[model samples]
Target: MANNNVSAICSCCSEMDGIFSRLLILTSSITRRLIEFFEDILLRDVNRLLRDSEINSYGQSQTSATYASSSRDCNSDTSIAFLDRNASDLDDHHSLTNSGLEIVNRNYHRGVRFIFKGLMLPLYCFEFAWGSVIASWRCSCYHMRCMQANMQSFVSRIVKTLHGSSDDIGWLQSAPGMAPVEDGSARFVELLQGIRNGLHKLPDSFVYLLIPGLFSNLGPLYFVSTKRFFSKMGLACHIAKIHSEASVEQNAWELKQYIEELYWGSGKRVMLLGHSKGGVDAAAALSIYSEELRDKVAGLALVQSPYGGTPIASDILREGQVADKETRRIMEFLICKLIKGDIRALEDLTYEKRKEFVGAHKLPENIPIISFHSEASVAPGVIATLSHIAHAELPWLPQFPGEDRENDDFALAARKVPVVFPVSAAMALSALHLQLRYGEKSDGLVTCRDAEVPGSIVVKPERKLDHSWMVYSSWKKDPEDSSEVDACEMCEALLTMLVELGEERSN
Candidate 1:
């Protein structure tokens, strides 16, 4: 009977070992597959741009020659002036096209990083589990604590590496011929770079933080993708790279600690900025931090943040879509690897709870809070123009139309027509929802009305700057119309506001 029991125990142990080995193999294969997929997507997109550039070179030469010939009939002085102006305009157009292509390339690279990170999720989990198992086996409290600390350091390194790689990807994807625009045409890029430079100069005054929204880890990538534009404008920005799956309170606490370190007990004001769920984090931190710490805040900028809540989040939660085992696993994997924190997972929290976390939180009345949003519009004419240009056919174009012609009034008007089927459908639904719901002003993801805060100065430029482009600037069409501004100009506006506010306070 003892011999039989020993044999049975051995068999059970063998079965368990086999299962563990199989899981490891499966995990390895999945990670490899995801990496390959990401690489393929990035390579294909980059290759396409190289091909388009060749095609565009031929077309630009032809256009330039035509413009030169067309101006021959005018008076010599007038013709000279016309030729210079025409050349400048062409240069601007080329620059804009190149910028757009750079953005496309950046997106592809970012997707690759996101997928690669997603694959790392299972490994991260396994590492955590294996460490826990070893600590349990040894039954050493000190060893367990050391292992936990090691795990924290390891995770921090992973997050930092991911953020750095993501930023490098953006810088690598920037167009080779694209020069920093010194003129007004490059205002937005210049402004963003200026902000970055300004922040770097006053490192003591800035505390870089991350605010994440629901979905995946795309938020950081989204920021990284636009980093070039911002860098060009002068903003030396960095992401905290905290995963979206992290609890809001935890994220807030971590950011607060980081801010404290940066401030070093000095009363220097720090700028807090976030996109989507990150915005929620900024608000939460401001709300919960000690009053003395709150006084250290100089400004809060939120990009496409839904302080109220996003309808998409409500839909995902209501449908129990996030509850599927496979879906949750996939999201967890991605969140661990690609994203910083999980905002949607907080779906368990009541709307009131979320509101209390984000909305009820108030900064000092003196602290500047600036909010920005994108209005969806479709301009067929601009689309047609972009379609004709071989190099400007960006992957994100169809979804984000008004971006290319952000400074053109006519383009803005054209966008109001609803060109794409999805946008048209969304527009129709939005109209009905607005009528039924009464005064609801959302652009599908966020409401325009809710995007605003009381006493906060809102700058709604006439151009239909999409959610992403609000931070970056596009070329303006009409030279005379100064109303439509880009990111660089926006930076100047912000500075002007600050100067004016400072003067008022002194008075």
Candidate 2:
């Protein structure tokens, strides 16, 4: 009986160990799949944009040489000018997107290797270590706690070094026909102070640029969270409130002048770090500004900027479709009231309007840029409770009685019968809109491809990180190894770019 009991206990231990091993493999596999999905989405979007540009170029070449070659005539004709403008826009768009894609691919392979070699295997070891502790209660908890403490200390050391004070933050400063960094630190400080002072009496047309995505407008919140992350690195830093009712261009111009007045006026070159739409604005500014102003820009760090535009936006603007009353109301609230009233009014502008502003600009090839992006995933059990609440509060459709419904024209058009039931239609439209709004791979608003710029240093954080949280700068008391890795990567990239810019000036 004693032998049999011992045998049963040993058998149970073996089963648990096997199960643990399988769980670790499953988790690693899921992570790998998520990364791959992001890569595919980004690659496909880029390839499509390239194909479209090529086709458009080919089509234009087939047109009469007289129309194409007559530069003065082309400038005069609005239609020709429109075509020419779009072509140029498309060309630049293609270049930036392709460049961003290359960066994404390079980092993606690195991320894959990091996950497999650095994270997964280590995680497995951790699991085994924990499992051994679980098998015996005698001093096991104490041992586990010690191990955890050691890991925490290791992580803290790395984080502190990478995100340390920016007191020595260095970049090349350029004046007209000259570039130098002798007074880089002093100049940056003076520039920051001037900008802050200028913001006190901001012009009505002057708008602080708002980048779209989560945490974009959470000002103080973002500062507290991210201040330490980049503070010690001597990078340029400023905090400004975006104005209500200002156009995107107006906002861009305001930021442009602010940087110009602060950095360029003082003979200091500048670097702009824009997240999401802010990135678009930075690129747009670079395109339209004078060569002198452009020359002053050392680099642009775009964190998940969608330069190619978003498919979700395309879905929202689908032609000939009338939005349901509820949908329209939500749109009005989000666009007119929230964005226009409180935030900048750019979000309310039509895609074509936004495109028009962006269409007029092109980034100079000489400037180096780094882009960071995050992958989107729909977790199986995760529910977007906010969206659900928004849906629940919407008014029911009147035309279709005995049913709770939201009636968009698209939903109405797809009906098999003359009178679609309200409840069924609402549920259908709700599901469709939810999928369009929250479904698929997106960091809320921007797709992975749209989030990153081509040829920029692209860092896709661990899965489950939302678009807004990618730039989160909160300090961790007991930071994980992965977190330290992320901070180090960002610091290394930023430092390398600054070094390169400095070198460029020396030459």
Candidate 3:
């Protein structure tokens, strides 16, 4: 589809079949890109021909008086301004097509063109029957592809979790131009020096409390090699012992109590360095801690944490994999009972739940909070965009039987772009679903926008890291897998910032 075209929601259906469940999205992506190839070629040439013919006719002498302007097809034609990839072209609001006939993609079944350039096929009595058949087939294909893709994805993740190896697989690869990063220390040496200078007046007794993320209970495993680097800076860093998969509210309350009596009541403030859910929990605890207790809590440095709940949590919790309906229930039972995790941990991370929590509790005043967020998906070819929500919501799409036409407006559709790598067919569905829900690209787990807080200072030169890569260096096979190392340095800087801010407030 052209850059000017907007996406619409699909009307594809699903049958109770297994093969279609997984391959449908992959198939859909292939089909949609093929359609784009054809459309891009045909549309561009047609417009060029029309534009040239008009120019030729305009140059003819006495063309206006002798050749009646009323007879010219210009009035019936819609002018198309061929768009380009420059940032300025995004502002083109022209909604007209060359011949004034709307073009629909065979796969996406959506888009708007200012100039009509296709065959003037006359509609007959078969229009209803044809549309009905197409809609039915679309729905069926969609469901099957989703099912197959998800099943394969779930199995792959399980295999990876148990065996700790799957890099040999042909489907997954480091995205083009995404090589493993060299050691992170080199990137932040200048920044670290500047921070050290600014915070040189800090007291020697302040402690750095490292709060690990969900399922991160093993001491400093999430922070990887960065803890040792901090110890060298004369900071006493300790990992908090809260249950990994517990509710944020519960963990926050518990963490609050632990912090209040920490350091044998010596009154040294605890600088919190939290990752993922740990970050969210720390923020919640800071909101509830009393002024005296809150005073002891120095600052917060949240890394790759979802301040807004991730849609993946809701999708997995509420709607299990199409191929495995019991995956959610079974995982909950096993993790909560065997691993001793709180069953409601997933629930606490829902968007609605977190919004309610933030609304109910206010953060402590004058506490310096620095946040770092990351959102990245493999930038695959046409296939990547197909799975994205933007492509799924084109306005020219056939409406589902259950669609609310009143809410389906062309203006609300997202612009389509072929970006993001669908790691698996299952991830394709996730990418597609997320994009449809939020109309934004995401790092398989969380949208970048959701990871940030309103008042926090974001690190410059934002890292293009993914959620899992923030902690585990082994998520990808590439050599540049040390974002967690960089993040640790960022946390150290924030810790220093907190001490500097505290001194300024005290004086």
User: Per-residue lDDT of 287-368 in model 1, one digit per residue for the tens?
Assistant: 6785756556666666666655554344333322333345456655666555554544455232334545544455456666
Give candidate 1's whole-model lDDT: 0.52
In model 3, where do residues sit more than 4 Å from their true spots? Answer: 1-203, 218-220, 263-266, 319-328, 377-437, 472-485, 503-507
- Can you write out model 3's per-residue Cα lDDT over 168-273, one digit (the tens) per residue? 1111113232122212233234455654445433345777777788777632345643564567557677777889788888898888877876745666778887
Between prediction 2 and prediction 3, which has the larger lDDT? 3
**Cα lDDT tens digits for candidate 2, 221-269:** 3322233333433444444344424555665676677667757445556
Off by over 4 Å in 1: 1-216, 219-221, 224-236, 265-268, 319-350, 358-361, 378-439, 471-485, 488-492, 495-499
lDDT of 2: 0.49
Q: Tell me which of candidates 1 and 2 scores higher on lDDT.
A: 1
